[model samples]
Target: MRLIYCCGVVLLLTLFSRVSHGGNILVFPVEGSHWVNMDVLLRALHSKGHNITIVRNSKSWYVEENSTYYHSITVPVERSLGKEVITHLISTVIDFERGALPVTSFFNMAVGMMGTFTEAHRIVSEFASAMFDDQEFLRKLKDSNFDLVLTDPCWGHGIILAKYLNLPLVYNVRWLIAGEAHFSLAPSPLSYIPITGTGNTDKMTFLQRVKNVVMYLIGQTQHHVVVTQTYQKLCEKYLGPNSDFNELSLSADLWLMRVDFVFEYPRPTMPNFVYIGGFQCTPAKALPQQLEDFVQSSGEHGVILMSMGSFVSALPADMTNEIAAAFAKLPQKVIWRHKGDRPANLGNNTLLVDWMPQNDLLGHPKMKLFVAHGGTNGVQEALYHGIPVVGIPLFIDQYDNLMRLKERGGAQILQINSVDKDNFLKAVEEVLNDPLYRMNMQRLSRLHRDQPMKPLDNALFWMEFVMRHKGAAHLRTESYRMPWYSYYSVDVGLFLFGVFLLVLTTVFILMRCLYRTMCKPKVKQE
Candidate 1:
């Protein structure tokens, strides 16, 4: 559909459109088990007068959208079953090669190669799934049409869907996508690149830096190539009259970062991108009685909330024991989220549970510090609670994000390999004793909470903007049309400059030879 945007008519049209769309908004969140955050956004948006229909293959279902949120095992909306399978296969191969499942070394090589190859495959899979769910989602719209399409950026599928359906699109980035150098496109510099900070502050050892760079290249190269292909293909298959792949990406209209500026300070920003931190946050509910009691029982020294996010589960039991031993030394109570039977020799001031209300735990006034695996969402929650962290980074962006936080003086960065008694206890002690750390966290928390509008509100605003303007043609960059060499300034300009330099050097050499020959007299000719 070719949507034309005529000035002055937009406001009137938007008014009419708003009146027409009294039903629920259809949201296509990323595929996986941790879509609880997305469900929160959907429910919250629905409460603001729009109904919500969720189309995902996740296990959990929203209480309100039971009718609209389809739960088919093979619904097909996820980016690509084939690509996902390929990623898994690569991960497995990496695991096998490293002789470890969670190895973050050369495994990046496999991730990059596999991530790119599967892009097209994943896009196809998600499109198929959307086709199946479209009928149901559109049915709800008859009485009240879908107001906008808000999607997780990880699923490039959403951008394509918005273009195809002529609906408003709001791109939600779950991580940091700033920094002059691509930051390996991991969102945050600390997460994307190695050798962060300088001099004494550099956390990575020499070997680690080499490993980090290699891993970053492998994963990012694959991501850059694959995402570009997937995005372009999506545009070609969908976008509008004069629209192509280049136009869609460059002119995204509105970009939403699911991160707070507080965490990524002194950032270089663009007008189209807005910080929508705490999108994953839920309203404060009373904690479970038992959990509350556990916090109360901690008393004077307070407690340490330890979790390894959803993806990287608890370390091996032996590693867990090492961590437990470290916790034993601290006067503070420890609440560890380990999905196993309680440790046999559990310490007096410690508790172990499969899961706890993570946000609730972080929110507790008595919560002293968090020991986490440094996932972006978890880091945001910790920052929100004004709590310092001991980030025991594992894989993906965890390490880099923790490093960034550490640089900002908000947390202590720890390595997974060095998670024993000494390092762990030292980290805990430093964060607990440092008044500056807590002060810094509070400063960031104030900035985070003081956004002009709620993150969801901002997201909705952008969604409507896309609808209001149809698609922002003025915002698209024309550079994507140029060849890669040209785009990188390796085109005619650089090529011609190089040729001139070569000619000058050759003439100079010839002139020197001529002068030397003439000076040598006629002896050679005679």
Candidate 2:
């Protein structure tokens, strides 16, 4: 009887202990596909007994107002980046890509895209302003006594909010408002590490390197004038004149990067940046019976899965017809996630659904090739499942993501503008027929899986680590605090150059004097 009573007490103690250790985590997430991955992390944290509270805009496109895992705090905002805006931007970019004049197309596309980016940041800045203007909300946030702030730095709202709340900040980050998080945190040499949208691999020719440098300058200018302009004004008004949005954005205690060395080119990184690529992936669950039957029907030919990701619901009608026609030429069964008009040329073997279980389908034994738009999540998931890709990249970082896989001999990239039945068929057939593509991807999968700890677990540890230590100040570098001249040691180099010139001038003067003295006649010296 005493033994049983003691066991019961121990069980109760364990349960209480878990509840006691729960940390109050405040999250500020970005919308669309970014939120998809952020939700995965939030669920994981909730399962570990952490209490999560999310701050979202009332006009959120994806985030729900209610959830069992986390409490939602919705800020009322009049405007947001809606679906229509994104769809129109995509359509315009696609049209530019297919334009007859290449130079005009590229120039217009660059300007229009940058303008869209600037406007989006401006809208995000307004969202942050709305949050700040609410006195009751600010009081509630302060009273909550949150342990840390987890945010996606693509927008600057979270960074500014974290500063206002005086909480330790951590990032569920890939792109910053400036650009890729690595460029902001690490030593990214333009000679090697390819800038996003440049489409150059780590290995580059002379002209490519020149192009890389030009793009780097253009990107930096865009970040300053286009991206940070609105955020900077908000920072000055709320956080005081000394506050810099760019600096605060880089001041996070930890960066849980959504990529790993497996998918990224080898480059320098900092201690605080943790790679948790494919952390959202898990073993496949049982597909619905109907879907299972479809997979089984494929038999020896296997199945090909295609998805354009969360934002791109469908392609242009003509492009869709061309893709469908290409699929008709293949022996394999096809499952494409599309919400566009039904293509007239769609093959009987192809199944078009508004949505499908992308991750689960990729894990299926009969899965053969992935036709993807080169989003980070899809690409990482593909790598995780050891599936080779037939990449049809459309916009912004999609081409770059495909380029990385292509560099590794694991995928084939087709230009969206030029995609037609013949070229699309050839690309798909090459990836499907080629054994090397599968082998290389499998090798990468093994490498990704062989890690000492799971990426998700590592991310959790770092998040909790920040909570325990109050912040990871020791792990974070002070480089962000330094000016550009100080960061690159340009001041030091200039000082050294000045000192060198001074010494050289002194030596020259002394040599002239000494020669004059030595060569002078004895009578003159006397």
lDDT scores in order: 0.62, 0.91
Write one digit per residue (lDDT tens) for candidate 1, span 1-526.
2345465578788766765564435566654323556666665555544555554442323223344433222243333443345446534542443344334343543453365446544555456346535676445434445556666655555556656666655665653111122242213344223422111123556666665565556555555666555555555544534555434444455567766656664444555666777777644567899888888888888889999876434465656777788888888888888875555546777888887899888888888899987777888888777888988765545666676677878898865556667888888999999888888888877777877687777766665556556645465345536655876677788888989999999999999999998977876768
Query: Measured by TM-score, how close is model 1 to the native structure?
Result: 0.71
Q: Per model, how many backbone clashes are there?
A: 11, 0
Q: What is the TM-score of each candidate against the true structure?
A: 0.71, 0.97
Q: Looking at model 1, how many pairs of residues clash?
A: 11
lDDT of 2 by residue, 183-210 (tens): 9979999999998887899999998898
Off by over 4 Å in 1: 1-24, 32-34, 58-147, 175-220, 224-251, 265-267, 282-285, 473-483, 495-526
